[model samples]
Target: MTFRPVKATSEGQFTIEGAGVNLYRAFGFHKPREFDPFLLFDDFRNDDPKKFEKGFPWHPHRGIETITYVLDGEVEHGDSLGNKGVLGKGSVQWMTAGSGIMHQEMPRGNAAGQMHGFQLWANLPSSLKMTAPRYQDIQGSDIPEIIDDDGTKVKIVTGSFWGKRGPVDGIAADPLYLDVSVPPNTRKVLPVDTYANTFAYIFAGSASFRDASTPYGVRVEKEVNGEEVNIRDMSGNRTLVNFDTGNEIVVNSGPDGVRFLLISGQPIKEPVAWHGPIVMNTREELMQAFNELNNGTFIKDQRDH
Candidate 1:
């Protein structure tokens, strides 16, 4: 019953993307290998429509998969393959940019100009790097949610949790993605694969991770009767909690409760050569991708017109 510890903490900083849309990037474009099988994560949650309405224009992606989960508002997307659709609230779009594909995502608020969503980039192994592109759009209603007697609600987005399987499957990494919420002062221990790399991103409220010996620069909080007795005062939003080799994760919520995304996956354990939306095994492959782009051959398969 080993517990995962907090490896590092990063504040979601202000950033601009998608035709100048304002947002925060939790991790991306730098330190590309902090977490294996996971490259980038962006939080595009905003209250101002002008800040995010322009949205991400037609962009090309290759050798990776992009998972977009919307919490509030609708994201209308269309691809060069002639695939077009809108992802309403709580819907998720898992797109595999195998060879290459150009697409655009435009966000429209749900009445109050409030848009909230997250986009996470998962790295594909070298074997599947150039596979055919695909898309799996799962609506909120289709996703299964589990509620515990202790007031903990878990929305399983990918993989299985609490004996229920998620809709998004056939992923190379076999990741477990869950949106978890725990009531104030409640403690919960979530099962995780012993071999997978696990992490949690706190988006709302505060919580204390396992009460193990803190890392060199990490502050520790003492516990009494299985509760955080000496709560630290420095916790903030967007904190990244990295766990060691463990089978379960323990979390204790603060007064306002805690809401976070718990994600874990099997590491690729290979060298990564990343450039923008494309990620490959070496620089030569990256160069080849760019060459194809310049030669107008990036999109390997053109969907039936």
Candidate 2:
């Protein structure tokens, strides 16, 4: 079995979004083609109400899908298509912004004002770029959690793994989004599709992605007993881990244990013209979307057809 090597390490930096809400942008708005099929990912986990209270206001999205997974708080969302709902703890909302749609997501923390969640953007193919918009809101209880004999738990969110299937289906990319937790010092090997592009985001604890060769253009550091062991010059919470082509991934956790999101999908290796929330195959199409939004006629209903 071939092992996917770590391509690079990126630390999520402080950024402001959604009406000045303080958050960390792990990846997006810069390198559009770095992760094919999957375009962007943001982790908005914060405890201070002042930092996230502003929340994401109304925005336009087209030719892509946005997946929002909440871990601790509630996210009230509404779209231009007259669809509105609330995503509580452990809930996930997969919205396909085909054609076009304007939406707003406001975060309301729990009683203690603690809010945490993630939003990932997946790119749609050219054929479905102008398809009708749709939504797949999956509750926390509906997601299947499989615990292995080795104490590794996987929350299947978008694809099948460990003999279970995820609720979000009919996706163009056929992605596998898994939330995995491995015991301390234990090793875990996850089986991924041989051809899919896979990557992991470390959020909870420290872990090492075992591979022989180091990835190009990525920063790597070693830790000894929770202390920085490599590159004493840099010490901070890292965000992203990109991987090379492979069918499996091996991970070894630190003393405090490890938790991360492993996401993989078939690459759509096509020309990408992205502008804000809209992504298209050509600049002309992107301009058309913007013009439609300016004209106040972006939403297109497919049910009528």
Candidate 3:
């Protein structure tokens, strides 16, 4: 099996979004080729309720599909489409801002006054850019989780793995979204579509997207679970590992284990004319979208005859 090499790595940067919600932006606004069809990934995990209480107020979006996964707390949301709901712990919301839509997401902390969540934006092919807006609200219990013999667990969110299908489907990008956790020192090989652009984002412990060229093996002077230990080619928390073309990936967990969100998607290689949340094919089209928004005509008919 061909193990895809690590194309690039980044520790991301801290930012504030949605009023005052502190967030760490993994990758967004720019993913030229290898990460095509996927635009943004924001990790909004915070313990301070004041940091997130302001939450995202009213916002407008077009030409993109946003996926929100809540690990703790709840988000009360309402959209111009007349949809309103609460996305509680472990819940997922896949909202397509096709044509145009205005929405607000208000986050309320859990009983312990903590909140954690992620927001990912996937680009749409030009053909489906102006399709009707849609929403896929998946509960935490409804999402399927598979466990392996070595205590490896995978929470399938939007794609299939090992004969089980994800809950969110019917999309133009055809993506695979998974949450994986491996026990300490465990090594696992996972298959990914050779053609899809894939990435793994480490959130909890440390892991090595180990290949033959990786430089990790013995223990080092690193603190782990109250002890100093070794980490073999381990990528620590809040890091993003993007892979090159191959059918599979290999990972080695550190002493504290590793938990991450792995995602892949088919690329849309067309010209991208982007302005804020509105993405189109040409610069002229982008201007048209904003001009319409200013003229109060942003929402399109979206009804196919």
Model 2 stretches astray by more than 4 angstroms: 211-238, 303-305
Model 2, 162-278: lDDT tens digits are 789998998888999998988876667889988888878888876777743432112437777888644311112445888888888878666667888999999999999999889
User: Which residue pairs clash in candidate 1?
Assistant: none
- What stretches of model 3 exceed 4 Å from their correct place? 212-231, 302-305
lDDT of each: 0.85, 0.84, 0.88
lDDT of 1 by residue, 63-172 (tens): 89999999999999999888999999999999998878999999988898899999999999999888888999999999999999999999999999999999999899
lDDT of 3 at 92: 98
Best by lDDT: 3
RMSD per model, one decimal? 4.2, 4.3, 3.7
Q: Clash pairs of candidate 2?
A: none
Better of 2 and 3 by lDDT: 3
TM accuracy, model 3:
0.93
For model 3, residues 1-305, the per-residue Cα lDDT tens digits are: 88877888889689998789998999887745557889999998888899999999998998889999999999999988788999999999999998889899998889989999899998888888889998989999999999999999999998889899999998788999999999998878899999899999999999887664553334476887998876455688899999999988888888899999999999999888887878888898889899998999997765322
Q: How does model 1 fare in lDDT?
A: 0.85
Candidate 1: segments with Cα more than 4 A from true spot: 212-230, 302-305
